[model samples]
Target chain A: MTTTLRTRQRFAKAGVLTGLVIGGLFAALPVLWMLSTSLKSNGEVFQNPPQLITESFSFDAYAEILGNGAQLRFFLNSYIVAFAVTVLTLLVAILAGYAFSRFTFPGQKTINAVIVSVQAVPPITLVIPYFGLVVALGLYNTYPGLILTHMVFTLPYAIIMITAYLNTLPKELDESVKVDGGTSWTALWRILVPISVPGLIAVGVYTFMISWNEYLFALTLTRTDDMRTVPIGIQLLMGQHSYEWNQMMAMSILGSIPVLVLFLLFQRRFIGGLTAGAVKA
Target chain B: MTSTTAPDTTAPTQEPVTPDRPRTTLTRRLSPFGYLSPTIVLIVVLMVIPIVMVISYSFRDNVIVQENSVFAGLANYTTVLTDPNFLAALKNTAIFITVSTVAHLILGLAFAMMLNTQLLGGVTKAIFRIVYILPWLFTIAVIAVIWRLLLDPSGVVNYVLQTLGLLQEGVNWLSDPGKALWAVTFVNIWSGYPFFMISLLAGLQGIPNDLYEAAAVDGANPVQRFLNVTLPQLRPVIISMAVLDLIWTSQQFALIWMLTGGGPLNVTEVLSTFTYKQAFSEYEFATASAAAVIVLLLTMVLAFFYVRLQKER
Candidate 1:
């Protein structure tokens, strides 16, 4: 009986191990396939067997596109816009989070509720008005316009996540800093900011991703190829006459690297951000 | 007594080391404002202004270039309600939300439960967790492109199914009206379930083990214990997750736009795509804005119930 029980346990363990292997392969397939296709020659993509790997790996796609100058401009544009949005969001969200979490003020609750209300509104709802406003402000084809529009989506998210995190921190540190002859501003810069670096980093990544991956506005607002983000640029690659599958796959993989690196670098805090976004307390 | 009194007077010669309170009433009141000012200004410019503009624009008549202001009171709203495209988008959005949310929840719960088993512990499990989460970090563009590749007529999926004799020929997964919506839902669920798994796992970890032991003592079966104990404990987490997923998936545009572009006669068009097509291709900003407003209202309704539920908990 004891032998049978032991054998049964072994069988279960083996089954689980096999399941994990299968799951891991399944999870990795699309990303791996992406990289594989990006390396393959254009003609090999539509083959019946589906070239999982090809002997004639070529950099022609990347080389040809990079030579065109459009891709380079798009990459530079995306970075500038994304970094600007990230920095701006972090600065604003950190201050607001500190205030909402620690301070007593008139209309505080109402302000927080308003922030919550912003999250409920679908971003698509604002696109038309934003188009009108962007044109009115004469920012129709500029970085500031795109950054400002992206902020509408990212700011509320940043505020909510940062505030939730800040509430978890003790208030005694702020009081102590104030008692030590520090002004509120000093307390904010010296005390709160350093302590909240993880949360700030998380918000920065979120904001950057929003700005970087934005499509509808990017596609509509930016007419010049130099102003297009990677998403829009890649979309344009799917033209009327023909679609370049290999080239599009290559661009998609390239476009994904920055955020993937950020996530890997700050996996722990990123998980916290994800949880905060999902399960608001 | 004399020594104590003398020391008290001597100590008073020194000023107090620190002050705990604000120096002035204004400073006291404005401290929070000082911290929140940047955020307040940003939100006002970015969020409030745009939303107000939307509301105002919905009242005007700007089906094309913004030339006229007829102040068509409720006409846009009436048209949006009565339009077949808008209604279809609404129905499709609702269906996508329901199907994706339910599928993710079930699969997520199963994955979490399985991972929580005592045998699947330590470094190996951590590796699995990390692998599972890799998909969530991918951009929507990447997801759309990769799924499009897999769902194409001569894609890897069809190739495998054919080899296995499950399919007689390659299926036009994206272009086919019957399959496009389900294909979108499938991609969404696949992209979403990992996050749910991790969340549910976290929630499960918080549940006490003694309840299971008590149920065992009562001779309750595994399924009975799960239904009676686990389900009730997980109710809040599940509801919150479902609400957030609904909003996120309902607003999904990039993936659908890239894959099918609401193709095969707009059968796959959700609100976001519908709005995009109307405003841009069709050149009807007022009607598009009306459709977007309906999406906001529906999502807000979902969000309201979730918020109230969270408050109750």
Candidate 2:
């Protein structure tokens, strides 16, 4: 009976190992294939018995993409817009989270409910009206237009996460500062903000990812290639040089690097804060 | 302590370190708004006004493309509701979201459960966890491009399947009318399941091992222990993830647009693509606004359930 039980346990372990390997391949194989194809020449892409590691591998695709002025502009635009969005979102979310966490006022419940519900407002719904709004305000094809619009989507989650983070902190921290002749604003900047770095980093990284990946608004609001971000730049790559699969793959890998780096660097805090915001709040 | 707090005396002047005690006056009551002004301004400008504009646009006749659009009471809504293509989009969205959400939940739970097993070392589990999350790190645009490469008729996917004797020949996965919707849905599942997996893994870690031991001591099998303890413990997480997935998957536009362009006879034209085409490609802003509103209402319904689920938890 002991031998039988041990055998069964071994079989179960083997089954699980098999499942993990298959699932890992399912998830990671395409990503590896993308990296491989990015290194290969365009002609090597459709080679019979498609290669995961091409014999003719080179950095020529990455060089072509990086050297091209138009493609480089996409990277620059994405960085500027993503960084700006992250900063602006953290600023606004910190203040709003302070309000929600520390104070009571009329219509607080209503305001909180509205903010939570704001996440549901479909972007397609807003895109039409924003087309008219952006053009009317003379902000079309501009950085501020994208930054402001992206904030609406990012702010709700940030405020929710940051508020939850702040609620765990004692109100006496603020109170003692007030007693020491520090204003609410001073206490916020000096004490609360410093301690909330981990939460803020999580929100900041998620915000950057959203703005970096945004496509519909970028497509609709911007007309010129000068203002287009990476996602749209990829689309244009498909159009401008039909089936330049190597360059397209290279641009995608380059486009994904920032968010990928951020996630790897802050994987634990990111997931913790994300689950709290997304699952809890 | 700076002089900044000297002039800010209120009820807190007497007892400075009180724990959010009731304000003695109205002037003192509205203080938090100082910090909240930026958020309120953004909410009003970005959310409140645009939503109002979209609703009003739905009532008007081709507003964005034309200078003067008249208020046509419920006319655009009627047109969208009656149009066969609109209906087709709605039907496809239902299938896409339903299948994608179910698959995500199942795959998420299975991988999460397996990773939660004590059979593996922490290093092994951590490696698998990162591997599982790999698909989710790429942007949807990159995901679209990668899949397009793989699903090409002569792509690696066909080569493997053909070698395994599973297919007689290569199939055009994206362009084929019979397969486009499924192809797009599969990509979404790939990119989306990790989120559910992460959440469920957290939920699994939260379940105590004592419960499993107790069930085993009672002669309960592995399946019985899972059904009895694991599923009930996880029901809340599953519901929340499913509702959120429905909203996210329903709003997917970039993936479909990039992969198939809702093409091959509109087989994969989900609501987002349908609405986008009406507004941009066809320049029928009126009907698109109406369709957009419908999509909004549908998402609100899902989100309402989500907020309520959070409250319940």
Candidate 3:
């Protein structure tokens, strides 16, 4: 009986270790493939019985992408839109979140319900009307137009997450500020915002990512190539008759770098924000 | 200080009718709205107004060529509902969402369970968690392109399969009509399961070890303990995640658009892509609006139930 129990324990350990290793490799494979392909020459990409690692590393793809003025414009546009959306969304969400968490006011419940329901609406449903609206307002192909539209999705979730995070903070903190002759605005800015830095960072990163990766709105709203974002830029490469696999992969890698760096820097906060936002919602 | 303390205590008792209350009450009534006004204004202009426009557009015969809208009543809806392509898209959406959601749930739960085990060291588990979530962070457009390259006729996936003696010849993954939907579904599952894993992992960590011990003490085996204790604790998370995944997967556009363009004869066309093609490719704005409204209604219904269910919990 002792022998059987020991053997079973050993078997279970081996089973778990094997599962973890295999799952890790499977999860990492696509990203590895992207990095590998980006480093290969065009010839190397089409080699029969494709290799995971190239024999000779090449920087030609990245060099070519860097040389392309159009691609640089796309990157610049993406950065501008993403940054604007992040700043704007954070400002509005923080104020609204503070109000929702700390104050009792008329129409609070109704507004909260609207915010929740807004998140449920499919983004595709509004594309047609948005296209027309942007054109009507003469904001199509402009940064402000895309930034405003991206906020439609980002603001609701940001507010929800910040509110949830604030709910955990002690009300006594705000009361103390009040006791010190500080108004609500001072309480939010001096005490609450400083304490909620992690939550704010999470919200900012989330908003930036959503705007950076947004495809449909970017595709529809921006008719000019110079106004196109990275996702749309990569998509245009796919639309070309001849496939430039290496260049395409390089562009994809470049586009993903900002997000990957952000994640690596704040993996814990991102995961916390995601789960908290989901659970609370 | 003594006088302040006495007033502070009595303030609550006379909160509604103090001599200074009216001004305080007015500020309290107005301040929250002041904080919320910016967000409210933005959502109203960008989201609510657009949706209202979509509803109006759906009722009219609006097209790109005709600048002026003509009242078409339910003609747009009739056209969209009766179109064979739209019907196929609806069916494909259901199939794709069902398959991908189930795959994510099963695989995600399995991964979460593995990550929860003690066999892996802390560093190793952390590294694996990051690896699993890498795909989820990537833009869908990039993911779609990467998979398109990997699943091409002579792509890496086929090459590996051939080397392992699993495939006799390179199969057309994106181009074959019959296989395209499944291919797109596989990509969706690959990119999405991390979400499920993370949420479920959090759920697993929240479950008390005492429950499992109690089950074991009751003569329950490992499998029995999991089913009796683990699964019951995980039910709410699972339902909420499943419903959220259903709404998301049903409206997935970028992956399908980038990979297949809803092509190889539109076999993989879901509602979002269908609406996109109708508006952009065919310039049928009214019909596209109608189709989008239907998709919106479907997701909203699921979301409503999810919210209600969460409230009950």
TM-scores of all models? 0.92, 0.96, 0.96
Per-residue CA lDDT of model 3 for B11-76, tens digit only, reads 221235456566555555567777888888888898889888898888999654488889999999
Q: What is the docking quality class of candidate 2?
A: medium
Per-structure clash totals for the candidates: 0, 0, 0
Tell me how much of the true interface, by contacts, candidate 1 captures: 0.57
Superposed by TM-score, candidate 1 places the C-alpha of residue B215 at a distance from the truth, in angstroms, of 3.4
Tell me the tens digit of each residue's lDDT in model 2 across B250-306.
Answer: 999999999999888999998999999999899999999999999999998888888
Candidates' interface RMSDs, in order?
7.9, 2.1, 4.8
lDDT of 1 by residue, B6-104 (tens): 111111112343454334444545667777777778778777787777776677677437576678788888988998987888888888889999998
Tell how far residue B110 is off in model 1, in angstroms.
Answer: 2.4
Docking class of 1: acceptable
Locate the minimum summed-lDDT window of 10 residues in model 1 chain A.
A235-244
Which residue pairs show backbone clashes in model 1?
none
At residue A2, give the lDDT of candidate 1.
Answer: 100
TM-score of chain B of 3: 0.93
lDDT (Cα, tens digit) per residue for candidate 2, span A157-214: 9999999999999888887887787667777889999999988999999999999999
Q: Rate the local accuracy (lDDT) of all candidates.
A: 0.79, 0.90, 0.88
